[model samples]
Target: MDTSASSSQVAAAAVAVAMALLVPILSAAAGGDGWEDAHATFYGDETGGETMQGACGYGDLFQQGYGLETTALSVALFNEGWSCGGCYELLCHDSTYCAPGGATVRVTATNLCPANYSKPNENWCNPPLRHFDLSKPMFLRLVTDFRAGIIPVTYRRVPCAKRGGIRFEMKGNQWWVGVLVFNVAGAGDVKAMAVKGSQDGQWADMSRNWGQIWNGDKRHVGQGLSFRVVASDGRALVLDDVVPPAWAFGQSFEASGQF
Candidate 1:
């Protein structure tokens, strides 16, 4: 890891923070067109060790393709874990620490910043307040001072831009089929996933097992499988024959559908 910051790096960061403060950014949660108020702080060091495995079940963040571009959503925004993979755009609104050049960061909501019941009054993640626990790199990209532990910010939900198609990691067996869905673009959160076997007469709803994984009862062995993915926007995309009849547990399947 590079332990030293070059002069150019510092100057660039200062400019970005300054611009972030001056920009009048308007954004959305997919419905509204205006940026909302929020507070932000940073966690973990340059290694990002503490930021890796999180509450969202997005195990191995970098291995899953989300590098330092991630944040932990406070209680107000986590939506009880359903907002796990949602994306947001944020910038420092106004702060003494802010330095020119609007610097906005698009980050995936990878974890939950749980409310501290013991210190509700002091906890930024307490209910009714919108906050973000950003990774150190992302925070430094906006503010130069690590001492500026917290800063006022404006944020809005944005579509996640993923490179590949949706990937489903198969888990469990035929009797209790569980699949972990990831790499989703657009409205990244999955409201529900309906699975149908080639031999089945109708689609079977899969309940949230944990995080992004969904499970369903019944066996679909030796049957070509189809999936109906319903994203947070309430839109559904049916991937025909997403899995082969010989599909087995522990295998990942990728389908060319974006939502």
Candidate 2:
């Protein structure tokens, strides 16, 4: 009956299934506790005027719009804007450079540093894999002296406690639909999203278009929108019928809970 070979095969299959389940759990744990020492530097003027738009597709820097007033991160930390909207708590460790109270500030990931794209010879934010190119205002807030060109800092990802609930911005028209998610709380950056139409039971995958914006080109205007969002830390939430049947273009919808 070849019982020994059959048992071995079954055992190997069990091990493979266990490993597959363990990978996601390990990844989530790593994402939650991943902290690193980094160097920080300031850019732009003290007033934050004349600041350029970031690679995350956010246009305004310090305005009333969403993602405004958020701090920009280095391109190294941006991870091609995948870290956009992710929140971090940073503290300056350099005694000489840090403020007297050792101030800690929470900042949202908004932009990417151009220096990361430069060649090794010309790279400004060089060597350090973890770096932060803070806005001039944010940088000054952490340092004792405004003249400190660089400061040693410790940073870790933290939950984003936005005032309101998670908001969804609607774009496109009756034929095509695009949705931009904002104000995510726990694990701010979305790893993936799926949308289900009220009439259809199937879930349609949404593609990422820089930062927190996700899009799906399905003619889903008439039906209500339900979203299943997966966070970077592997937390998933299904917000049933978040977008009501009477949704309009450019309108924002808020969900009660977050991932």
Candidate 3:
């Protein structure tokens, strides 16, 4: 028997099993309901730009952009954008930096804080897992002083609240149909989407292009669009006949229900 090769295979299998075990623990740490202790710092204006966009395909939340509030999470909190669009309520606990009453603010996860993005000492996600790099305006809302650079915070995930109902943006034409979902409420991020054409009477799975967009090549024009959205938490919502038969490019349709 090749003892060395057998040992190598066993080592590889052990590593794989270890990785599988770590996944659930990490996921729970990132997405669990329990409030977690974390650190917070602010970005934008003081750092440089007023306008910014995130890897999750969202524009700036501070000034004029997509009109959504923005919050950048540490690499740990970002979870590779799996936490995109998710809302979080953060409460400041540092008596020196934060007010005595412990002010709280709710913000949406819009971006990732990579290691190279900031100074080595300021890299929040490196060793410590839970961290938030909030927008300057957001951070100020929870603290009494702007001079204090970072503060201790307790944060928990919350359902997103959108002003309008869920909006569907059409990108493709008759032959190929591409739709971008927006203003998702509960669970925020989309895991999967299925589209049904009025004529076909069958559900067709749409491929995730990235972020909130999904596409499938099928003649769907002149056919009313029905959508089934699966949120990141696996909760599914079906909006029957959400898109009208005369749907046009660049037009957005609102669904009666949000996910």
* Total clashing pairs for each candidate: 6, 1, 0
After TM-score superposition, the amount by which residue 23's alpha carbon in candidate 3 deviates from its true location, in angstroms, is 32
Q: Model 1 over residues 108-183: C-alpha lDDT tens digits? A: 9998888998997899999999999999989987776878999988888889998778877777864677788888
Q: Model 3, stretches more than 4 Å misplaced?
A: 1-33, 45-52, 59-68, 117-121, 126-128, 172-177
TM-score of 2: 0.74
lDDT of 3: 0.75
lDDT of 2 by residue, 49-126 (tens): 645466765545443133324666665677777898788877776448788655677777777766645587555455
lDDT (Cα atoms) of all candidates against the true structure: 0.83, 0.74, 0.75
| Ranking of models by TM-score | 1, 2, 3
RMSD of 1: 9.8
Ranking by lDDT: 1, 3, 2
- In the predicted model 2, the residue pairs found to clash are 75-113
Model 1 lDDT on a 0 to 1 scale = 0.83
Worst 10 residues of 2 by lDDT: 60-69
Evaluated with lDDT, which candidate comes out highest?
Answer: 1
Better of 2 and 3 by lDDT: 3
